[model samples]
Target: MTSPADLIINWDVARSTASRLVPPGPSLSPAAAAREVADVRQAAAEAVGYVHTITGLSAAEGLGEDQRDVLVVDRPGWSAANTESFRKLLRPALDAVAEKKPQLVSEGSSAQVFGSAAAGAELGGILAFLSANVLGQFDPFHSSEHAPGGRLMLVAPNIVEIAKQLNVDRSDFRLWVCLHEQTHRVQFAAAPWLRDHLMSSISTLSSSTLGRADGLPQRIVEAVKSLRQEMGQQKVSDQHDAAAGVPARNRLLEVLQTPEDREIMSHLTAVMSLLEGHANVVMDAVDDSIVPTVKTIRRRFEQRGKNRSPLEKIVRKLLQLDVKAAQYRDGQKFVGHIVETIGMERFNTIWDSPEHLPSEEELHNPDTWIERMGYTPKG
Candidate 1:
């Protein structure tokens, strides 16, 4: 049997490489950095109240103030936090992989060292890229005896940089970002079972996929090559498709080996879409009275996607971030339709239990979910 150590990737390498590879965060003087952090903390605190009022989800009973505190971090800090999350989240799947392919780890010590380093470096690169782009995230998997509910994190420098790039009011942008992330915090807070449900679902699917991961590495290489080629062709054939990067995303999906894997992926996608979409809805739900530049922010943010450099676009496609963007749109449509048709109070039932969640098909066809949930059809 492969030892636990062998099953686990060398996360230290991942952390260190990410630290080295991640771009330095936007420039800020000591005072400016302090001010930004304070502002983010304040935004997060205020956002919690707005998210509660908008979504009707509050911190679960018994959550401590420590668990609810928002941590404001820079690029490297964000990278480190996510690295830990990946470690915890992937542990079970890696164990399953090791069990299925004991020799995969039982190779000579030199091979183990090289394999760990290689895998860590690859993950590190992805983390480094994402660290630059992510403004804020709520990590539900983080836990300790003192604070079992996990912490919310805001990447201060990235938020500042993106706001500058978008040429929006800085305070409005900050609060907008907080509103989205705070919704996520409120989500897990309201549905305490959600954390375990997601973790279980992810582990189950990941185990099966990793177990059948023959030719996985070759598939990844081919996927990238094909996406790059498709991107180039789309540049000549259709500028819109080139920017959208749909083909690349489809190619990436080929990594799943079975129908069951695809089903699991779909289910997970739907859940993510709901979470992301609902957050987006809540963020936008606040009107001009609160976020005065809300309309302008939304318009420019959409345009920012169309304005990425070719290299950044390629990176985004490779990371499946384009799919994440789609989730927001698809999910937003589903939530918006449901909320408009039935109202937010009725919409709250979706979070009542895992069974109440929408399936992938239901996301595209919100009427199906509504009907299945025993709601009256829209007139």
Candidate 2:
């Protein structure tokens, strides 16, 4: 008795209802971000094997066709049509890699490998969005290896969004972003174990949360509200500083969540730094001929990010604790200091494994990392 149009209407209503419960992002407190991040990671980890079997592009394709698992994702910055083009290009590249690298195939959907050969292979997957953000810059790469079976994932930014954000032509944005994406691909390919280490670390935290998170988000949101009020129209930067009036903020958060959760958060932050840091490095290495816009692109974009946020705050309030644009400025400074002192090559070691990734101590105190490496923080 139900018409297709009626079905469509029902679906729309359902989706709207569902979204009401979900945060719109950018405004999410660290707690909410962690919750979503964990859910996504869990789904991907669970589906890895099944996706591989379906795709026929397993790590052992060179020796024999592998029916291993694959990672499933929604394309980050693409249309259905654009997605087809990316798949056409990427599938062949991955197929070729599979032909050569039998060691990286997915074992089962859970990132569980059947054998050791496939265990340490470079793992890559894509998640896409169709918004106005730069491709590689907006895209997030979680780890260099997949655990249970080592794997890595890099979500590409929507071409549409990246071009829009960069305020140049889409082609120009792609030209610059491609370096970061390729850099990620190359590093993960070279060190497959890196992906595994990161994935396992993430899983440990995520699974633990799911086990004990029955009333979590509800509880965490309340604490986040208190923290936000303490932040009280203060710029975002003020809240993150230790000297900020916010009390037991971090510690209060941990009381509700598990250490594994904190570790995952730290690991992911390190992953983002590893990625953004390298993109800066490699773009610097390449001749300007490859992309004339490379030099001024990052700075121009950062300025836009800062200046644009008050408007963006309207959007942020829908999902996250409202923080002023200053938080990102602090984040950039943090990232810049790492790049200045470690040199891109060494700053990148964070991507190599969980062990190498900077700790909370390191994020707050780069001096510790510098001391350990016998390198002082660069001015």
Candidate 3:
């Protein structure tokens, strides 16, 4: 008997609950904290200049001249910031849903109160798991209309903990992290339309979800059943060769009942893969003299991904981190293939406009993208 309004999540409560559940770890000594902050700031600047040089984009081009600010925060701070961002992003869709059905909440009904509390708890649990593992994030909405650029957020405690766990040289690892994140900044700066394009796509998806909310529960159940069947088939295929498991598909996208939902998700996945892949390539392309431990760091990082604990792996799967990791690998390979075949100058067309962006299928087969882009591979 719960109304749809009752399901509108109380994200503020969720943010607070998540922060409490995943509180920051042991505090760094004052000197260590200060040193870390300084190093990150320096790295951020260096990375921006380095990426600009490598990408060959200047301010006169679409690249914005504004500088990106860096903020170092603990886990709790990060959780709070991201919760607010999610709230902003989701509010329009929620409001649209309400407009379509005015009677979702009856006057004097307590269902809304109870539903909000329950939704908050669910969201809190998910965020609690994610906050621990996220090292850094680039938030496009961090700035106001007057300020057109974004900010780079470094989760100080998590970064420090990860470095300690991996036993990597502290400076090298921190710089490496900054390099990847900064590449993202350069991407947005170079392609000012990208932020709007992503936001538009996400809004479209959210609106679609809202329009289909009435059947959402049933759709989700059906999707789960379909997924289980697919997994069974995958297991049978795996039995032939344990090392060659089924290829990783975007399982989340596969679960959507509507073709529209699946299409939006595919576009989003392709865009994300391109961005992450481009960042990975740039980070690795840094001269060895710049990062003496670059090879060791890369090896250890890949090992960390492969050796996650069962609990951690479940959490990752829930948050779609597994999908993100797959995107990184797939994207990196796609970028490498295209660059090697057509050369970087031709490959750079992908950034020229939305039309130049590859489709999800094209991401798996660079040759298709190459042909589509009217580029012939070198002999």
Candidate 4:
């Protein structure tokens, strides 16, 4: 059996490459850095307190605790942290690939070495793109060695850069960002089962996909054919439209082939949509008295998404970040619709178990989930 660490050779190269690709933000003086860190820490704590009360979910019940430390890091630090997290998350799948290596390659062959290099390079490029864009992430897989359990990470530089670009008040914007991330912290903390559920889904999907390597070539061919057919149907003017031109059935979907994989992916999508949408809801629902600039911040943030440069737009499509925007919008709408129809208490029941989660279709049609859950709106 191959070790997970052996799957990606020269990960340092990936880290360095990503760091290089990320543009540097204006440097903070020593005092400024210290102050920023202090502000984020305070804001994060307050945000958590607000979320706990607003969601009506006790932190002790959800995560078995009330608070987690928040770590503020620059782009390079954030990228490095995420790279380690991804390694942990992807290890099981990588191990599955290693188990199949003998059948895929002969002893003393250099193919494994070459493949690792390519994989590492691709992983690096993807991380590089993400490091430049992600504002904050509450990593469930964060290493305890880094801190007690895993602390919430706020990418200080990215937050500062975005706030400056939007011309928003830094203090309010900082707290706003913290609120969203802190909500994620509260989510996994409060719903103790969520971390395990997400890990299981990811592990199963990865192992299933990697274990089917023998059929990968055919799957790729089919995916290419599907893409071509999709392209052929689109008008010339629509050819470059990222959202419409690219069909949802891509290489990963084609490779996973089995009904089991599809089901797993659907579950994963639904859960993520809930998590993301819930965060957005919590962030927006903050009292205007607390986050006075919330409306302006949200409006400009939406405009920022619509006003990306041509190159940035292409990069977003390639990095699958475009799907992220859809997730936010679609998920927000879904959660909002359900909550409006059945109330937050009924909507919160979806988090009770995996079965209660919405399907892809149910995400758009709240009635399906409402009916299936047998929930009736208050008279």
State the displacement of the C-alpha of residue 263, model 4, in Å, after optimal TM-score superposition.
Answer: 1.9
lDDT of 3 by residue, 271-379 (tens): 9999999899888788767778988888898898888899888777667676788889899999989988988778887888999999999999989999998899887
- Would you list the C-alpha lDDT of every candidate in the order shown? 0.83, 0.43, 0.76, 0.75
Decoy 1 TM-score against native = 0.88
Task: Give the TM-score (vs. native) of candidate 2.
Answer: 0.48
Give candidate 2's whole-model lDDT: 0.43
lDDT of 1 at 17: 94
Clashes of 1: 0
How well does model 1 score by local distance difference test?
0.83
TM-score of 4: 0.88
Tell me how far the alpha carbon of residue 346 in candidate 3 is from the true structure, in angstroms, after superposition. Answer: 2.2
RMSD (CA, angstroms), candidate 4: 3.4
lDDT of 1 by residue, 17-107 (tens): 9999999888899999999988888887777778777776545222223334578999999999999898888888888888777766765
Better-scoring candidate (lDDT), 1 or 3: 1
Tell me the tens digit of each residue's lDDT in model 4 across 1-379. Answer: 7454554444666677777776776689989888887887777767766777667766523332334456788888888887778778888777777667654333335775676667767777777777767888889876575444466888887887899999999889988998889878877766667777788899999888888878888877876777667556755343453544434544345443678998888777777888898889888788678888988998999899898899889988787777776678778999888878988778777777778878888987879999999988777
Each model's TM-score, in the order given? 0.88, 0.48, 0.87, 0.88
Off by over 4 Å in 3: 1-7, 59-68, 103-108, 145-147, 220-255
lDDT at residue 164 of model 2 (Cα atoms): 60
